[model samples]
Target: MKEELLKTFGAQFETPLIEEISTVGKLAEVPAGETIMDIGNYVRAIPLLLSGAIKVLREDDEGDELLLYYLEQGETCSVTMTCCMGQTKSEIRAITETEVLLVMVPVQKMEEWMAKYKGWRNYIFESYHNRLNELLLTVDNIAFKNMDQRLVEYLKKKSEVTKDNCIRNTHQQIAYDLHTSRVVVSRLLKRLEKLKKLELHRNHIQILEL
Candidate 1:
């Protein structure tokens, strides 16, 4: 676990801080498709992802959810941190995109660590900057990019996150993430297939090239 902390975070964390984290944090394993957090829910703890990925999403009153981004490779979900910090309920949803293992820190420790541990303070600020940049990029994609371009980018991101050239997801699932209809997704996918960019099969999409 210490090795994972160094590999994911860095060697800059003080040994005492690491020891404190090791003591206070509890290990949690979340199965794929499990909701880790939801909108309007008070969170008890924040997770430090050790392995696998979690998808962060925004939802509305109509039950529509849009994929905001993914938290992976030991990254903390800043939205959750914000909610915890402000003593407010979560404004977004988080779900395990894969079988994930994480270290859960008690909610109260967030501020304690910041005031007492330099490493924790740095980690929180870094997490904020990273998440904010990602959100900005997502907004740019939606506001400036076309659907076909966005679809291609989305497919590429999924493949990278899953670490597989062959992605196993249906058109409906893809549509749901992009907040579009299945028909629109299928049409764009067919167009990409015609251009030999990808090969489509039953519940599978094999990438031919970028």
Candidate 2:
């Protein structure tokens, strides 16, 4: 399972590295509403989110949390990568329960792998490229799309093909996903709910009609 999860990083590298990683790292189960890692906390590894959901958030000067979409199953967390790369301090947190397969690559191991395996380097680069593309698309959406359109489009895109249903992403989270204020999201969600298009439950917002 770990091997296949890492395979999503790229097709070039051998999945056997997951076994090697297992020797050096460990698996963690984070319960609902738990903080897997906090902003400004330094961690020296990359985590493959094996199950459940995690959110990336940025806090405002007033100490309010802004939702930054989520890192869903099969998707690795960006804060983990940034920390591993020794970049700026992370400003994100896990917003939901999650299970992660952690891989810690020391400096020596990084150098050795880069020297010994071209495929390994290709795999890492590819993962970064894909992340950049996701970021770019996000930026483009925020710049060009209206709030209603963006929110509806995000729901449509994330909905399951079978029933066109998606996980109950919260209003605040949707506001963050749209890069808008939660008050706006609240108003919009109220409007959507009134239209009989969605239903709200404790900590969850379900789309009732596509």
Candidate 3:
């Protein structure tokens, strides 16, 4: 665990901070599509992703979910950090996009490290800034971009984060993430396929043009 933590975060964190995390953090391995955290859940720990990807989502009152952003290896969730600091329930949901390995650092340690480690404080602030920018981009996509454009961007983002051009999500799954109907997603996907942007398979959509 120590070695993995150092490998993933060593460049950004000091050695002492890494050593402390390895001592106090609990390593967790989660399978793909598993919900690691959800709305209203009290966050007890913040995850430091070591491998694979996790998608963070927001839910509406009607229970529709929208993908906010993806957290890749060597990243953490700022929303979870905020919830941890505020002692509040999670307002968003996090699901493993792939089989993920992460170190779960207890919430209490977060505050201690903030005052004790400059590296930890800088990491947390940078996380907040990056997440805020992503959230803004998501809002812009919804407010300005067409559904087809949004779908294309979404696919590109998924491919970039997972490092796979073959997207395995079903039309319904994509629809759910985009907060649209399956029929709409299917139609757009078909249009893209016709335009040679992608190829539709029985279970996956293979990128041709990205």
Candidate 4:
């Protein structure tokens, strides 16, 4: 299982060091749409994605589902720092069936590892920096981009069903991804369709560059 994680990364640094990370438990074939961690629940182990994709989503003020991001194989855990810092409530959910390798990593253990292993500590530091940069980018997008621009970019990335070589995604799903109302998405989509900018087939939207 540890070998699988190395696939996501470019190269294996040191086999002996990774092998020394005592395996906690193998969570195999986790069913789709299952909550790996719950809001207000305490998370102990550091989860590493061994296989499958996971969707990180949050609920908005009006009880709407908003997609934060998708986590794929090779990416480390998300929002674990909040859990580590004793934050009781988490705003994300796992939206896909995922196989994860859980390491029994406590805060003290992390400190000890940092103190002893410079290489491991550097890896951890880089990981945190990457995560912080990602969060900052999301915040910048939200603060600077207009709603339509954000929605358009989001749909372009998320449209999974490509029919006839055209990107297709549902309006409701796009609304969830945009953290806005479905009706707003529908209205905008229809307007775009009428303007010959895009085409709509039932719930599926075909993106047109024009």
lDDT of each: 0.87, 0.62, 0.95, 0.60
- Winning candidate number (lDDT): 3
The residue-by-residue lDDT of candidate 3 on 1-210, one tens digit each, is 999998999898999999999899999999999999999999999999999999999999999999999999999999999999999999999999999999999999999999999999999999999999999999999999999999999999999988999999999999999999999999999999999999999999999996
Q: Model 2, 99-199: lDDT tens per residue?
A: 33334344335545657777666655765676677667767777888777677766765563213364556777667656678898888777878998888
Ranked by lDDT, the better of candidates 1 and 4 is 1
Count: clashes, candidate 1: 0
Model 2 clash pairs are none
| Better by lDDT, candidate 4 or 3 | 3
TM-score of each predicted structure versus truth:
0.95, 0.72, 0.98, 0.71
Measured with C-alpha atoms, the lDDT of residue 38 in candidate 3 is 93
Lowest-lDDT window of 10 residues in candidate 1?
3-12
The top-ranked prediction according to TM-score is: 3
- Candidate 2's C-alpha runs over 4 A off are 1-12, 64-66, 97-111, 154-179, 194-196, 200-204
Sequence-dependent TM-score of model 1: 0.95
Model 2 TM: 0.72
User: Model 1 over residues 7-29: C-alpha lDDT tens digits?
Assistant: 76666567887777788888787
